[model samples]
Target: MSRTEATGIRTVLSERLLQFAADRALQTREFERRVAALPADSPARASMGATLSAAKAWEAGLLWVAWRLQPRSRIGA
Candidate 1:
């Protein structure tokens, strides 16, 4: 994915996260904890996970999208 694509994904994920947070039932800490519980490599991270499936899906997609857009740069090469 190009940088622009990554930006778009990030925007989407951020917006979704914000929406989840905005919900009266979801506390900030609870929302964050659910996000943290998702596997680092899991697509759910970008979405809701453990907390709420729908939210996880959206968040996971974002993370997946970002992973795609990330540049291949060697570290300490």
Candidate 2:
């Protein structure tokens, strides 16, 4: 593929990955809200806490991958 085509594909993939990361962040926030709403003594709270932790981890991984995929500036450009 041409350089222009390759760059366009990378840009599209990067945008999509960033969007997915954003969506994961929003989901993690919703999980946080739910966990906060539950009573301290509730048994479901423990399960919700676990779920929240997993969600946070997933979001972090997505964010890291997205960061890695981003283009870096050249030193002398």
The estimated TM-scores of all candidates read 0.33, 0.80
Residues 1-77 of candidate 1: C-alpha lDDT, one tens digit per residue: 89768777766766665555455234544777766876799876765544465555565665565455444556995
Q: Global lDDT of each model?
A: 0.60, 0.81
CA RMSD, predictions in order: 12.2, 1.8
The reply for model 2, stretches above 4 Å from the true place, is 75-77
Report the number of the highest-lDDT candidate: 2
lDDT of 2 by residue, 1-77 (tens): 89667767767777788899898788789878878987899998888888888888887887787777666557986
Error of 2 at 18 (Å): 1.0
For candidate 1, report its TM-score: 0.33
Report the Cα lDDT for residue 41, model 2. 97
lDDT of 2 at 19: 96
Residue 14 in model 1: lDDT: 61
